[model samples]
Structures are given as C-alpha cells and as structure tokens.
Target: MAKRASRRSAAEDPSWACPCGTGLPYADCCGPVHRGEGTAGTAEALMRSRFSAFAVGDTDYLLRSWHSSTRPARLRLDPGQRWIRLEIVATERGGLFDSTGTVAFRAHYREAGRPGTLDEHSRFVREDGRWVYLDAQPD
Candidate 1:
C-alpha cells in the first residue's frame, strides 16, 4: 500500500557493488528493482533484490515486494543492525515461467556489534505476474 522510502542509498551509486553478493554493480543488480525502474525477472532475482533492500535500508522496496496476503501493516527495521551479505542456498520452480517458487538462503548481518545469520526457506509467488515474497516455509 505505502510506497518505498529507503533510509539510505549507497546502492544508488552505480559503481558500488551490490549487497546481494552477485558480483555485479548495484545498478546492474538490485538497484533497478529498488528504484522502480524494473521488476525482478525470477524468484531468485526477487530474493536477491530483497536482500539488497535490507542492506540499503530500503523498507519501502521490501514492503512493496511482499505478497499482499502476508504484507505487514508496518515495518520497523533495526538501525543498529547492518545487513552484510546474502547467500542463496537453492531454489525450486521459480523460473521466468513458473507461477510460484521457493528460495533457501542465508542472510548475514551484524546487530549491536554481534554477527548473525538468518537462514530461511522462503516461499514466493507470482501475483498479478510479478514476483512477491509470501512467507517462510516450515523446514
């Protein structure tokens, strides 16, 4: 419902490396999705973009990328937490033509000077022909 409002924009620099660990520049990777210039082509791309969003503090993009069914009314990100990297473990059925998919990933971060990782097997679906995060799946 509400539009994206990023807290930072280091990714707005085309030369900056994308936080998604894709070895691509931010502009070439998730920046477009964050900037509303394009949409993710696959579930994996959406997952990566969401990771990038966290790194850049783009809560707007995160909420926008969420499926309406699971989207929260409000989001509060930890200012003390810094997202460090994203590692996609695997994926299933979320190709360009697929209607739904699942992505397993580990998102590394630092919070209050402590390092941690959030590992999740996430579900995604094509809603109105666009990829949106649904929810975390049971292990």
Candidate 2:
C-alpha cells in the first residue's frame, strides 16, 4: 500500500480541483450529487466527484452516486482516515445510451496508521438523462 500510494503521488495529477475543492465544501459541484440532488454526466466525472467526496468525508455523496441496484444500504467512512490522491486510469464513453460505461481508477488514502489503496473498475448507467455509479470490480 505504501508503494502504491507513493507511485500514484509521484506520477499523477497532483493539483486537480477534486470537483469539490479543498475547503470541504462541495455544494457548488459534487455536493449536489453527493447530496442526491442530481447525477453526473459521465462515468469518469462521477468517479472523480466521488473521490472528492471521500477526500472530504462526504459518504452521502458516495451512496447517492451509486446506482440504486448496487448502492449499499448503509455507507460510512473511517473517522481516522484521509484520502491522499486519486488516479483515473481509463475511461470509456459513447458505449451505450442506457446500458453501460466504465471508469477504472485507484484511490489512495491513509487510515489508522496505515496507507491503503482502493482500485476499482466501476460501471455506470444512464437513467433519466443522468449517469450514476453502478458498482466496482477488481482491477
């Protein structure tokens, strides 16, 4: 986990705006979807905003972005954790109008004295003209 986090920090977009920003306020952007007010436009966009939510401890947004079919009944973030970085490896658009989409990425974080990574190939679906996160598969 240490190695993975180091590599990502060394070789990725270090200054990206997190869709939510650094002050922990997401209301203008990712906050809406995180609050279940709206949905994202693309799989990658949703994924990025979700990462932003994690960085700021917005579990509500995480669940809201999740597809109804796959969204967990309860969601929580470790109180001792902090997200360190996000790396979007690949993304596919224009795949299907209402069927499928994917975003492959790795999220690095530190928790309870340990550094860890969450790597996933996430699926998305478009419903009612908005894109929502479906689920994640091992990379």
Candidate 3:
C-alpha cells in the first residue's frame, strides 16, 4: 500500500508578508478590489496581487481581474493544496497608450502530498482602464 499523505489547506501554509516587509496580511493589504483599496495600481501591482490571490486560493478575485478577452469562464481550485513561494523575475512596460505589460514569475506549490512548480511569463493588458490577465508563455 502507498504511504498516507497529509492534506494541506491555505491556512496551514505560511502567510506572505507585504512586499514592503510591513508584516501585514495579503488579504488585508490588497484583497479588496471593489473597495478600490488595492495598492496595485500599475501592471506590477496587479501582478503581485494576482500572485497573492493565487497563494490564498482566491479564485473569485483572480477571475475578476482577468481580462475578458482571454479569461476563462471558470477557475478551479484543487483541494488539499497550498502555495509555497513566488518569485517574480522580470517586468516590462509597453508604451503609455499601449496598455500592455508582461511579468515573468515562478510559483511553487504543494498538493496531494506532492510538490510542484510553475514558471511562466504572463501577459497583461489594460482594458477599460483596468489591468487584466491575458495569458502565459511557456518556459
């Protein structure tokens, strides 16, 4: 028989501190979108918040922030999963009026008693004056 595996939840995972090292929770810092209280105003800000949302398994926020042009109809979360760490490699901006941006990041997580990593360069575009996730590039 296979060894038993312990399930993990979001609360059991390590909490991410603000980029500022203020020791603040991500949900408290950039969790609100309707309140217009998010600190992520630029492309990078949006990217960070999205990553944080993923860490917390905030699928609704992720879907809401995604661009309609490329956003999928639904997002699924795997049970017994928890994100480990996030590493943003690079970010670049297009022209002011272009309203397009890119972010390269590596996201590591654990699920189903296994560890996994996802590295991608994601594309983002500003539509209707809001930044939205477009797609991811293969490594």
Candidate 4:
C-alpha cells in the first residue's frame, strides 16, 4: 500500500479570536459551526455565527443558515470589504424554547480603507427545528 493517511484532521488555529467578538478562540466558537460539526442553538447564536461567516467569507454557511423562504439563489460577498466588528443592539425572543426571534445589530466594516456600518433588524424562525434567517424588518 502507498502511504496511509493520518487519522487526525488539521485543527483550526486556536490563536485567533472568533470574528464575532465573543472573546473565545475560533476553534471553540464559530469554527465548529462552519465545519458543520454543530449548528447555532438559538437565533442569537445563529446571528453571531452568520456575522462570523461574513467576516470569513463563508457564503455557503450564510445561505444554509438562511430560511428557505427568503434565501436567495446565490450570494456574492465583496472581496474588498473587510468585516471588522459586530455590535448586537438587542434581541427579541429566539431563545432555547422560542421558535421565532429578531436580532438587531450593527456590522462594521472597512472597504477600500473606508469605514462603514450596516444596521438591520433581522428576522429568524425555526425551520424543521433549526433556526434560519427569515429576512430583515422594515426600518
């Protein structure tokens, strides 16, 4: 036989803090969610993971976590935009037992060396027992 493969998988770098600003290492936070090892347990958890996904440019996770009713056919993240920070403004329901929730947040980024912020109130609901992004509420 040619060389046998090692059973150990490449571990995520533990030095990097999670992009969601949770103060936890990436591997112990969004890394597992991105790897499909687990899902967000609550709507707020899902929101945090989604923000981290944008920072890391994981379009697949963004689409997958989106509600089918509102998910777009495709998504294109801007390569020049670097997501730098996330500030959760508030949360409505979307807890461990609730089926629906809303997350109000501000996502800060820098594009072409210019800083900007996006504020939105996102809707979320349980789809087949999993929390998924529904849409944004009208301001």
> Against the true structure, whose lDDT is highest?
1
Q: Model 4, range 1-139, lDDT digits (tens) per residue?
A: 7774321122256777888889997789988998889989999899999998888888999999999988999999988897888999999999999999999999999999999999999999999999999999999
Deviation of model 2 at 9, angstroms: 25
Per-residue error (Å), model 2, residue 111: 1.2
Summarize candidate 2's per-residue lDDT along 2-98 as a digit string, tens digits: 5434322322333434433333334555655655666666677677787877776666767767778888999877767878778878887724454
Tell me which residue pairs clash in candidate 2: 34-61
In angstroms, how far off is 75's CA in candidate 4?
A: 0.8
Error of 2 at 26 (Å): 5.6
Best by TM-score: 1
* lDDT (Cα, 0-100) at 61 in candidate 3: 77
Q: Please say which candidate is ahead in lDDT: 3 or 4.
A: 4
lDDT of 1 by residue, 24-120 (tens): 9998988888889999999999999999898888989999999999999998888888899898999998999899999999999999899999999
Winner on TM-score (1 vs 3): 1
Q: After superposition, how far is residue 98 of candidate 1 from its true place, in Å?
A: 0.4
lDDT for 68 (candidate 4): 92
Model 1 stretches astray by more than 4 angstroms: 1-7
**Which 10-residue span in candidate 4 carries the lowest summed lDDT?**
4-13
lDDT of 3 by residue, 31-52 (tens): 4542356535667667777766
Task: Please tell me which model should have the higher lDDT, number 1 or number 2.
Answer: 1
Question: CA lDDT, every prediction?
Answer: 0.91, 0.67, 0.67, 0.88
